[model samples]
Target: MGMGTTTIESAEVKAAVASLREKAPFVYGLTNYVAANLSANVLLALGAGPAIGSAPGWTGAFPAGAGAVWINGAALMSSVTPEALDEAAATAHRAGTPWVLDPVAIGAGAAEYDAILGALLKHKPSIIRGNASEIAALAGGAGGSGVDSTLDSSEVIDIIKGLATRLDAVVAVSGEVDYLCDSAGRATAVRGGDARMPQVTGTGCSLGALSAAFCAVVDPFTAAAAAHAAFAAAGERAGRRASGTGSFAVAFVDELSDL
Candidate 1:
């Protein structure tokens, strides 16, 4: 893939933010227990409604009606079953609802986890967001240690583009300089977040939820770029105001609300 490079302008991101607030789309999230609170808070702070549940009955009904959906790979480690996720993804696909996939720790975990993620791909997610290691592993490289990425986003530009094309989805790799690629091979780089972002748990998972919110109102490429831009800007602001990791986490949500 001959990837064309681009940057997401502040105006485009602002428009996405404004539209998201106005629409306040309901987002269904199938995230793990560890990240659920932060994920829901992030969505709410962004002015999007968030509904999270693992019950098979609820999963069966919610995705079809929600404006967008988010599926985190870690959810499978808990109460969420692969069958339930498949039902949700299938329902969202049938309803024409855009969804985001966060393939967390994909290559670093048991083969069963990887198998679950692989099956989710068949439903055609609108956007796939993860750290470099997760994305690289999904693209057939050695994954990182757990959720921490050993490879940087810059190291896997071509791989990211290829994955985007193969999945027919916008793929966003989170890192110091976030990278985004659409199915058409259009690539974008968003750079601005604070280094302390990784110190806070659930930041990446929350980002996947935010991406789903943006996807409800914009094209997948634009939506993915906008979400990254939003996080970059907010994280920078929160980092400046925070005293520690805990404070930074609180300030991050506040900054997102202000955005």
Candidate 2:
């Protein structure tokens, strides 16, 4: 079937946001060091509990018990080993815990890094989120420079649909307009985020973590779309009040809380 496109309504986004506040799901993130603080803060602001740990023992335990899990490929470059990430994915799978995979700088990395991310595909992530370049790379195209997307989200709609179907997961490509596709080839285009969002470090990475939080309450497709919708809405609000990227970061979290 051809991919169907739709926009996430404000009511749907609001319902998902309200559910997060009511449930306050515990989200375990094995994310990169640079994104850890912001990722956890984003979860907290959304009224979800955040736990970030990648110690040998914690990796297996946290994902198994938390409401949801987030695994960022950038974590491998930091303190988390490939084995730990694999174990986390395995554990989440075994426990039927929903998890989001952010393949940050996937194709741009060395062979070992790319191999680690490729191996993760076997575990079957609930959602896979990345920039246009990263998603394109995941679909066998060239990767972005570092974590930056070299292409626009619109440029990779078909790849996102293919990846979503092949992986049986919700795949989200973040750019000027975020695109999210599910296994059934249904896609959502969320537009509203500010340009300054990319200027703040970890904003995109934190979106993966936020998706995990939403997954704890909704289906993978809804969770992924809601995350983008929430980010877009909050980014729009924050951009209006902030002086620069630094203030935008703070205001973004504040807007999330207000949501």
Candidate 3:
């Protein structure tokens, strides 16, 4: 929290949104599955526009003129071919657009998977959001399952810290306690969320988009804080109202509106 920690005020959040709107309100999403739709909607709800597309072809141009870019590899490997990802990432990189990376199922082995990892390194994402396992794997700690983080947040602090420095980007790891780190070797842990959040499929993806939305408005650190705050508040609000994963989904959307 050292770098501009106290600067995350309401005015800052508002200014970020204003910048986003002026910049095109368009957040190009390079991802897979309905989660991509969910993430795009999340951005729209937060006063930004969303465009869900793959990491290739015309989708590559989508980020060239957007406020921010959010990438989630959840269903990517299954849907968008590796060639598509390569093209899209190149477009984003050349444009100098701030992009977020959600490395779903990272550390899983396959030629395409490895290729995606290499692409991420080349893209030099501004922000990388993943759960503990995914962050750990990205940082050379351990592999993770399909977006399901297997390690405790505290256990991966070192890896997160190291990765943030090495990548020169912000690294966010979600868990019981969420940690956000930057190249400065500083980190902040945010708490307060319903345990039921994990039961929902697209919560993490939604959070990633939210982060990009904030990034569109503010610096990386505060963007992370706003995202963390919004998600935690929404989760807590939805917890009491949700009876199960199904109900939680509805409640979570409602909570997003409330936030």
Candidate 4:
């Protein structure tokens, strides 16, 4: 379904977040080692079941049973072969299941991961969420350092839009403002998150995970919006209650659970 000009409101996003409790969806993640724990925790906080699996045989069967699937290219492993990921992503694509792709530190990783990421790009993902540098690299632009963006998200809107057009997916660029854009000319910005968010290790990846979880119940466009909106809300509240990154992470997760 084309999103067209749809702009999601915070109230609607909160409702979608609440719906997760009733749906109790399972969001499968073939994610990086670093993001895996926080991603799973974030899903649990949002009342969704999370399964982080990179086992060889799970490629086909995991997404078949999952409400949504998330593919994160953060940490490449010897066991989680690129071929296995290809099969898993293909399974989700063929099944018409919603999935999110978080291309973490795309260029900083081992050289082989570049090929793996390129291979997965052929498959259509429901959404792609990444920092400006990551998104730029995905669009054949220059990449930045590991997980640290050289360019601001706002600086790469055109690149992201073009990539979203070519990939037939909603692209979400995370920064001071989160922009969700699709080829259909639909774009929206979500604001109101704490500056301390970047200090946390898994915040961006967790958002991608939450996007996948939301996709199980809603369309990709709304899923992106809802994920950012929910994060913005919880992060703002968490920042008010906590002192720094450590306490903020705990409070953030707690706020999500309360929401």
lDDT of 1: 0.89
- lDDT (10s digit) by residue, model 1, range 112-174: 889889888999999999999999999888878899999988998888888988999999998
TM-score of each model, paired residue for residue? 0.96, 0.96, 0.88, 0.93
Weakest lDDT window of 10 consecutive positions for candidate 3 = 1-10
RMSD of each: 1.6, 1.5, 2.9, 2.6
| Error of model 3, residue 11, in angstroms | 7.5
lDDT of 3 at 95: 91
> Which tens-of-lDDT digit does each residue in 96-196 have in candidate 4?
88888888888765567777877787778999999999898888888878789988988988887898889989999988877789878788888777999
Q: How far is candidate 4 from the true structure (C-alpha RMSD, Å)?
A: 2.6
lDDT of 2 by residue, 1-259 (tens): 4443333356777788889999999999888889999999999999999998888888998898999999999998797899999999999999999999999998885778888898998999999999999999888988788888789889998899888889999999998888888887677788888989988889999999999999999989889889998899889999999998899999999998888
Q: How well is each residue in 97-191 modelled by candidate 3, as lDDT tens digits?
A: 77888888888655468457656677788889888888877776667766777788888877877888888899888898888888876677777
Model 4: weakest 10-residue lDDT segment is: 1-10
